[model samples]
Each structure stands twice: as C-alpha cells, then as structure tokens.
Target: MTIAGAQIVHEKLEAAVKLLEVHNVDTWLILTREGYDPSLPFVIDIETQDTTAILINKSGSHQAIVSKEDYETFKQTEVFSDVITYDTYMDEVFLKVFHILNPKKLALNISLYDHLYDGLSLGLYHWLERLIGSNKLREIEVTSEPILKQLRCVKSKAEIEVVKKAISHTTDIFEEVFGKMEIGMTEKEIGQLFVDRMKMRGVTNGLGKPYDLPLVCIVRCGLAHRNPGDHIVVPGDIVIIDFSLRCKGYVSDIARTCYFLKEGEFEPPEDVQKAFDAVVDAITQSIEALRPGKKGYEVDAVGRACIEAHGYPTIKHSVGHQVGRATHDGGTILGPRKTPPRPQVEGLIQSGEIYAIEPTIIQDCGLPCILVEENVLVTDEGPEVLSKRQLDLITTPYKGVK
Candidate 1:
C-alpha cells in the first residue's frame, strides 16, 4: 500500500512475466517517463519505482530503466535484472536496451482495436518513435490491448479477495440507502449518501478508502432520469437507481429501481416486475451457460434472447464486462454486436476472471422502470452472483423500506 507500491507491482509484473512465458509473448514493455502522462497512474498497479520504462520477456528476464532520482527506489525491489537509471530522456536508454535484447517483436502500449490500446497517448507514441528512431524499433506492435487485457482480465486469488470485499461493502450500502430513499428524495442526495456510507465504512486495515467511489450513482425517477443523466428525483415517482462502485481498486455495480409508493396506493406494476423478472431469468440462464471454453457471445446471446423473447427491447449495453481495477476490465463482452466475434470476447471466460453481467431493461409504461442490474463473476465451472441474489421487487413503502 506504499505509494512506492512499486514493489507490490513488481510482484504483479513477475506474475505477468510468468503468464507471458506461458502464452508465448516474447516481450511486454511498459514505456513511460513522467508517470503522470502515462495511461496508467504514477503509482500504477503494475508496480516498480520511479518514472521508469519496464520490459518483461518470455525468457524470464526483467529490466527497468528508471529516472536517476528514482535509482534507489527501483533498487528497493531488486526484482529486475537490469535497473538502468537515466536523467534526460529514456530515448537512448530504450535503444540501448532493445539492442541488447534484440527481440523479434517489440510490443508497445497502443491499441486501435481495444479501448485500452489508446492508453499510450498519441504524443507519447510520437516521442517513443523519435527516441527509438522509428525503424530500429521494428516489430513495435500495439500489443497493449492483448497483453493488458489478459494480465488484468484474468483475476488472481488476491484480486478476487479485494473484489469480494468491494461487493460486500457496496451491497451493504445499497441496503442502507434503500431504506433512506423517499418519494421526494433528490438523486444527488442518494448519491452523496453512498459516498458518506463508504467513508463511514472506512478503510480495511487502515488501508484508506480503497478508491471506493460510487463512480456512477443513478437516480432515475418517473421517466426523466431513466437513462444515465443528471436528472432529479421527485415526489410521487417511480425511481430507478443504477450504480457502479469501486472498492480497494475493485469495482461492484448494481441497478435496482426504487418506486415511491404508499402501502396500498397502487398494486405493483405487473409489466415492470415482469421486465425485472425477465432480466433475472436471463442473467440466471446466461450465467448457467457460462463456463470455460465457451465463447462470450454465446452467453451474451442468452440474456439478449431472454428479454427480447418477452417482447421488450434488448438492452443497448453489453450483457456483461470483464471486471477488475477499472469497472470495464478488458476481455469479452457478453453482448457482442460484431459478427465473427472480436478477439476480446472471443475466448472462453477464463477461470480466474471476474465479470459483471448487468443486463438492464425498461418496461413500457407511463412511468419508466429500469428492470434489473446486478453483479456476478466468472468461475472455474460457471458464474457466481456477487450480491445478495435480488429476486423479488424491492418494495419501498411509505417509509422507504428496502
């Protein structure tokens, strides 16, 4: 947990190296100078000290080119084979390092296909090109998407523990917030409540807030705030709250509607409940179908077919996403639009991977209702629900009961 959490990241790097060896990736390089400008944070999860450039090879080799100021910091880990220090720029440092390694393919953090490929900024890419002198750095492929997607997508035992804690805390917060919500409650108030609850929860082992911010706290009342937006909640309304939270750098997301109703004012809307049920069933069946060696699109199709068969429109978003440090960890989309399947969602849902199969729907009615949103993870055999399996409708009575 040290800001120089570099040592810990070194462990992750070592783990990545082992994985790269298994997968036959000759080398994986993380090139960055000012830490701040890199796609990842200065105290990034990958670890290592200083604003250093890293290279992990299939030959079980590791190297670090650090800033002179951070030479001691890099030494603290003693993990890399070459811990070279530089002052002005890593341009010459990179060339020297590459000449020594002479790798057939040099992978860089640039991906046009995957969202994460853009982690290496265009400007930085230009800088790297200039430093390496273009052609010298032949086979400089934008392999960031595949490398990072796999390294991060496939969860570790330690990572899963963090995610479990995140799921536990977020669900507990939802339970408490469910009681506080009322007809006249504003969306911002509820969102702030989630923030406050997280603070009260405090950090684990004094580790601090675990980066647990409800990045998205949705409060959709009536039909105004149904979709993700800045709409306010009002009295005598049908409110739907769809939110995702991150804890300990692990994320958990759930979207359940809160209808503000008097005890006997109106019967539970059958269509809305039905829509919610459909999503639940779809999620259940899809998760059942989830297993290693099965393509992601197949699982996505299960959920898509469930709601679509019920005569409701399929959710626009993907059925699920690979979950990790960021909310949308790279791997596969349960609901893939591309034909022949994209590489990300093509492979099986790996055993160590965790995911959020959040399929949402809106029943046609005077008052809009976002059907269901819950969190689940891929497992050795199948999918597992992370939250306290929400089955029935959450009836928020006059007192705002959960």
Candidate 2:
C-alpha cells in the first residue's frame, strides 16, 4: 500500500495549507528532535537524528532545516520544496528561512490541551525561544493544535480504503473463531486461535514487537482475564470479545459479544439480550446524532443517555475517538469528560473524519458487560457506518460435552 508514502505526505501538506488559512495563521512550524513528536510523520519520511524544523507557509511554500547527515534523505522524499542542512547549529538556516518567508504569525506544535499536538519537548520549546529571538517569537507563536488536528483527523480517499481493509480483515478473523470455538477452550487457547487466524490472513503485527493476541474474551462474570487455574468456556456463559489490528498503516478497532447456549437452545438468555439491545441502541442513536458541525459532548451525551435509559450503567470513558494512524489518534472526541472538555472536544465534527463509537454497559444482572465498538465516518449527509454492524446477539450452540 506504500503506507505513509510521498503521496499521503503531499496530500496532507496541501490540506495543511487550507487548514492554516482557516485558522488565519501564516506559518506552520514543526520542530522535532529524535522523533519525539508524532506530527513528524506527516511532514517527513526520513528519520532525523538532530533537531529538524519544517516551515510550511500558508502561501504554499515548504522549507525544511535538517541535520547535514539527513539532508539527502529528507530531500529524496520529494515532498519539501527546499531542504536546508546544518552541521554545527540550525540557528543560521532557521533564521535564513524565516527572514525570507517574513510571516507575521507562526503556528508551533505546543498545546497544553491535546496530547497529539503536544509533540514538542520542553527543551526544544525553550531552545526555539532562545533561537528565534524573544520578540519575533512572541509576535508569531501560536499553538498548531487546531490546524494540525483537523489535517490529521480528516481522512482522504486513499486512507479510507486502507482503513476498510483493516476492518475487513479483523472481521474475517472473528468469523473463523466463531465457527471453531468450543466450550472447553481456555481463554489462552481462544486467544491463540485468534492469533493463528490473523496470521493465516497475511496480517501480522506491524509494531516493533512480535505479534500479540487482541482478544478480550472474558468468560467469568465481570472477570476480564482467565486465572492461572484455567477457567474454561461453559454453556450459558456470555463471552465478549474484542479484536483489532493494523493492516498496512491504518488500524481497525472493533468488538462483539456472543452467548454459549446448551443443546437445542436457539437464543441468548433474556437478561443478556436486553443488555445487548441497550448497547446496540446506544450505537444507533449516537450515529444518528452524528453530523457535521455538532460538538463531541453533544454526540456523547446522546449515547450515554440511551445506555442509562435502558436501565444500564453508563460507560465511564468517552463514547468514542477519532481512529487513524494510532488507535486513539487525537482529533475530535465523541463525548466530554468530567475534567472539562477541551477545544479539541468542543470542535465541530467535519466530514471525512473517522471515529470509533464504543459504548459499553456493565450489567449487574448476572450478564457480562456488553461493549460494542464500531467504526464510522462523518459525511456531509450524516454518519456512514464503516464496519458491518452487529445487529443480533451471536448464539453459539453448546454440546455440553465438557
């Protein structure tokens, strides 16, 4: 898929220009050292050893000041217009570019609110202050949270396709396990099955470490993991499983629940189905409430209300989050928190952004917690459900042979 290729970088850069104009900022500065900042992926492809500063102007000019050793590497990316290299210090090249651009306002990646935009280190932040001269820094420096957040949150056509592939592969793995899972299998055994299925599909862990199982098949009432004594799956036990993985660079996070029934049983227990219905209701109402220009808190409130109205306790976390490069890729949140919602949370939902709306209900009525997370995209018309929605409770027949 040429994941994070030059084309994606160019597209994001172009979007950055429009976003900067929308925010009325003249210059966007991405300062990084040792890749501590997450926004570096959007600006450059090559790894940087020393402090690198990328200057993107609202007038559509891209200039980069990188270490001499990384100059050729950054230049080969074909995304930046001009690449300047520095050996001893970056002060000379940094001032040289700023003087030429002569922008009155500059956007820096420093935010006390959103962690996604708070990529710049305190040491680098102070170094930039000393380098840019105190007066010019004051006149120009503004947080780049709004501009970069919008650019990263909104998915392009190509990105959406990659996300779909990830979701599809995840669904395939879950379907295979549903057919083969047995009542005597332990949680570890079930987890291995999911891993084996993912490997068979040609999707492995894209992280630095080896592949890890992504299952959350809790069997005992309210217990998240199996104990050392080996708790096995049994009939009448509710199993809630969550599976997610990265295909190419995009990620898919999804979950579903099923009930193990005794022989001749065709449906789930009445109490379990009622709780599952509440979870489905939350996802449906939340999606219906999703539209461009609505705030995160408003959308989250709708889902939370639905869960509570159905006689279930509301989920503690936010209703959902923007899904992209990272699982919790920061952008617009689905709901507000008790800590007070930031501007990122209150920001209007824009079309082309993807979010995972997960509303969970912890049932105290002998049923396991029902948590359903689905991926959706916000469009001009409304919300478009990306992953195939789970409409009914999965009923797996149990032979009770164990």
Candidate 3:
C-alpha cells in the first residue's frame, strides 16, 4: 500500500497547532484563490480548485471551504474531513466560519518580509479585508510563514517516490543524449534533443503533470553556466548540461559535465577527474550530515569549505536548497556564504523530505565545471540518492556514430 502524504501534512498541521498554542494563537487560516499573474505556480495545485479556503483550529477539526462545483473533487483528496460548498459569494460563509470558531488569533499567509511565504496578492488581500466588514483581524495575525517553510522543506516517503521516478527518467534521457552527441551540434539543438527524447520515453504523458520539462535545459561548452556561447563543440571543450523537471509537483535538478573526446584522448583529464570527485565528495559529506537537527547556513558552510579546500571557485549560489514543487525548492542555503541564517536546515533534513545537492566547481579558465547534482530522501538512518552513479565524466566515445 502506498503511503499518502496527506498524513504527513496533517501531522505537520498538528505540530503547527502546538506551535501556535505556545504563542496563544487559536486558529490558522489558509486562503487560496486563483492567483493573479503568478510569479510561480503553487505547490499545492491538486488540493484546491480556482478558489479554496481552509480553516484549521486547535482542536484539529478543519473544513476545506470551496465552491460548490469542486466539492466532490475536494472530498476525494481526504485532507479535510468536511467539504463545505458555497453558492455565489464567500462573504457570509467567511464571517460565519470565523465567528463560530472565534479564534483569539487567526493565522493568515501574508508575509511581506519573506518572499517565499508571501503568496497572498494585493487584490486578494483587499478582498479578504472586505469580508472583514469594518472589523480589523489584525489581532488575528498572519503567521504560518515558519510552518509553511518547515513543512515544505521536509519531504515524505510518497514525495520521495515521485521525485525518484522523475529523476530516473532524467537519468535515462541524459544517458541517451550522451550516446547521441554530435560535435557540430548547437546548444539549442542538443538541449532540445533531451526534451524531444523525454517525450519519446513517456516523461510527461507517462508521468501525468505536464511541466515545460525544464524551461531552461542548458547544454553549454567551454565557459559553462556563464554566457554559454552558441559555439560549435570542439575537441577539449567540456560540455555541461543542467536539466530539471517538475513532476506531479515535485521538482528534480541534475547537471552533467562531459568532455569532448578526440580520436585518441578517451577519459577526462586526471585533474578534471579530481575536480569531479571533489564535487561528489562535497555532496557526499553534506548528505551524511543531513538530519532533523542541523542549522541551514551551517550545512551550507560545510559544502563551501569542501569546495574551497580543493582550490575550486566558490559557487556563487548556496551549496544546496529545498526541493519540492519548484526547482530551487526553498529558501536558505547549505553554502558557506548564505546571507540570512535560515536555521531550518536540521528541520529540513527530517524524514520524508527530498532535497538535491548539486555542487558545480569550475576546474580552470575555459574549462567546464564538474557539475554534480542528485536528489536524495532524508531518512531516519541517512539520505537516499534518487539519481544514480553520475560520478565519472561521460565522454562521447566517437562522433556521428549514433
């Protein structure tokens, strides 16, 4: 039997209620409407329709308030015990729901300070105030930023399985591209090749959710992750490809760096191999330290220190981040130089969470980096890698052979 993450979400909600109890907040409210010019899609796309509002109390009793049309579908999710359907307007229902619960404090998802938690729009906020009908629920404060962040950081077993499936497909596509590499191929051509191949392998239609399948699937040579030119692949040019997938909400990010081999030169240079190993070593060390009780910034520093010790260029980005519905899944870094100390690292490594640790270390000038990234499940014992052995550099044995 498959373990649905509905249990995990409910468990987290219970923990959140406890957290609110400590703060003396009585009720938590999560309002969802069709977003306006969304910067990014919501992770909980399946939970609600165009309009939905969830009311959870300290008693652990809750209702998923949605339109009448979606009541049947909403009931199927089983996340909420009662599915309350409304007719035309939400004003009367909204007020009555709050009045009965009469929470001392109602936690809403309105965080102006943190961009990640700031999902409520200005228009929707105005609408919410309209429902207030001249009363200020400022006392009903907007909390749950921390709860939302922590909940998403931790991936459950069900989440891990879905991520694992997406990553395996990614692995197959990456391998196929290596076998089908062409010397004179443009970055556009090679990048699209994987996208085309994914279709053939039943990645989207087979998997369900139709993500653009990594809008920026990049294949670059020479200077990678920079202004990667449309240069023709030449011998000694290190080709690097960064790919991602938003599979049924969970996202996977993986990058592979391959060297252009001549008739004689076969494997990657010894120094380059060392650089690649260092990238893996950094990932290995970071994954070992992951658990339910570590600091986020502190974890990032560990990865940074490892990369720098090898005399590699410190990645401009963090060591690793949260992976859920979005690619750069959550805020906070495992890199040494994260600005804000997101102390949620240890909590993030809790059981049922999924994360990707991809460290890109530039070997030398004009040389491509050994970009190594793979998804892992944070288990009670340790982390499990979803994407398998991508350690050694994959080189094109012979050009125009496939």
Candidate 4:
C-alpha cells in the first residue's frame, strides 16, 4: 500500500474502534473470499483471492488471517497488528482468534436498512454460522449498520478532496457542453457532448450508464430520470441537465437549467424565471438547515416549505441524500417525515458529511420542471457549498433561422 492508502486505513481503524465502543460491540468480523465485502476497501483497501478473516476489537486491536499468497500484502498495510497466513483451510486459525478474543458481542456486515453495510452473502453467513456453531453465532451476531452509518457518511480529509475534484470536473464539463449547445441539437447529442468530455478527462459517470447520463430534459416533453432521447432543443425551450461524475471512487451529482432564447428575446419568459427563482430559493433554505444534530427530515421540511410558499406542490423525491463512494451513499435521507418514517430520515446530520441537496419544481402546464442541485459539506460552523451555485438560469441564443 502507498503511504496515503496506509494513512487512510489507520484513520478508519481508529474511527472503527470508537464506533465499536459506541455500539457496545466487543468485536467486528469481516469475512470474504473471491468476492470481497463491499466495506473491505474502507478497512484494508485490498482484496484477497482466498478466504480471509478480519477482526477488529473495541480495545483498539485488529488482526487479519489470509492465504499465504495474500499474507505479505496484508502485512504491508500496517493497520493490522497480526497478519496470520494459512496454507489451505483457515478454520483452525479463524476459530483460534475467536477463542482468544472471546467477544461477548460480535458485529457482522449485515444490515436491514443500508445495502452498503450488508456485504456478507447468505452462503458466507451460513458458513460462519457453521464455523462458530449456531448457538454461539446467534448469541453474538449483530448488525454493523450503526457503525457503518457513520463510518461511510463521515468524510475524511482525503475523501473530501477527491469529491471536490469530481465536482469541479463535472461543473467544467457542464460549462463546455452548455456553451456548445445549439438549437435543433437532439437531447442525445447534447448528452454525448458530456460523455465525450468525460472520456477526454478519463472520468466515468457517477451514477448511471455513460450514454444515459446528463439526463437532458427539454421543456414541454422531456421528463426527469428518463434517459436522454431524440428530443431536439428548440427556441423558447427550457432544458434541464442532471449530471454527475466519479473520481477515484468518490462521486458528485448536480443539475442545472438552461433557456434557449427565441428570436427577439434576451431572457426567459416571465413564468420560467419565476419557477427558476422559486427552485433556487428552496435549495437555499435547505442548505441553511444543514447543521449538525438536525434530523434529515427537518432539513427536508425547510426546503419543502419554500416550494409551497411559492405556490408549488411538494417535490416527489427527497430534498437530498448523502453523496460519497456511491452517488447515493446511504446514511441519512433528507426526505418527508411520514407516519412510519424511515429510519434513514431520522438520522442526525453530522459534521464532515457531504450531501447533494436538490429541490425540484415540476410544472403542470407542460413547462419544463426546475431542478437545481448543489453539493454541500456540513461543518460545525455552518453548511459549506462545494459546487458553484447556479444563481441564474443559463440563457443561450437560438441558432436556427427564424
């Protein structure tokens, strides 16, 4: 492992120890083989070809048991105090570690809510049950969701830097594509412009397929989430581009609205401008509500209130979601507080967490909906906006002859 990689592992392990204590877990066990656990990267930053057993204790000690071929790699990470190797069967060594630790409560990578915390496959889980004996496994096994919720949600200094770079690159691509857009260009063509730029930069789409991204929605006919199609940009059309990109395992998501000016027009129509302003106001209020200790639904309500105050219906989706390794890196969800509120929405906002706050306004009169998204970093002092805010609608001239 590189020096930086080792440092990240060290930092994560330190945090994991505290989390284990917080959850009252005596130890956390991660088991993997050819298909490694999804959470493995955050722990060791490497994959093992053979079955591997990683144990982390609340007492701030960690150890790894891997095949002989993978032993040296685990040692180089320097995060584990002991790197034990096995020739073939790891049953002996794995059980011996459990015997030595004798943890009363053991957490496993199983979750009812977050898929990121549910990395252990059914087969592997059964294998563990047999290895540890059914009675003992049931007595100790608990979900690692609580620990993982914070571990993945809270951004380290290095993770934040990578996300910022992704945001920067995404915004730059948006600028170039919007500038080159001409009336009569199909939505697919406009979407391809972004794909082409991403290729030049050697980055991949953060959330969806390459050709399907930047979800180009031309007003009057286009809808959100649907892949860009053959709808042509026309004069007087309002366009929405929802774009995201990934860099070094981190991702960014952002959306912007643009207006194609008709002949003799220098700005958007009055109604279009009103809708844009309302969406921006909604996003602003949501950001202001992003403070540590606030629940996800509270922040969502602030933005929904803004939309309603401006005479628009509540948006169908959440106001925002945590963004990180995955586009919708799971944790807290800034969404509605329903009768049976989801556990995710009840989660408290914390410092060092990055969120993609998008408040949308869909029009009933066939006008294009307005969606403006911004990436925010929650800090102790206040919310810091990471992406450049789209304060006003992007206006472009119609090149087609009248």
What is the C-alpha local distance difference test score of each model? Answer: 0.64, 0.80, 0.65, 0.88
Ordering by lDDT? 4, 2, 3, 1
- In order of listing, the candidates' clash counts read 5, 0, 8, 0
Preferred candidate (TM-score higher): 1 or 4: 4
Q: Model 4: runs farther than 4 Å from truth?
A: 1-4, 209-212
Span of 10 residues, lowest total lDDT, candidate 4 = 1-10
Measured on C-alpha atoms, candidate 1 has an lDDT of 0.64
- Candidate 1 local lDDT, 287-337, one digit each (tens): 787787778888888888887897777777778877666667666767665
Candidate 1, pairs of clashing residues = 6-48, 9-46, 9-47, 111-117, 300-334
* Global fold similarity of model 4 (TM-score): 0.95
lDDT of 2 by residue, 209-326 (tens): 3367655555464534332234577887777776667876678888888888977778876778898898999999999988999999889999999999988777777888888877
Judging by lDDT, tell me the better candidate of 1 and 4: 4
Query: How many times do residue backbones clash in model 4?
Result: 0
Best by TM-score: 4
What is the per-residue lDDT of model 3 for residues 80-139, given as tens digits with 9 covering 90 to 100? Answer: 667788888777787788778877777767675566677666666678777774367664
lDDT of 4: 0.88
Worst 10 residues of 1 by lDDT: 204-213
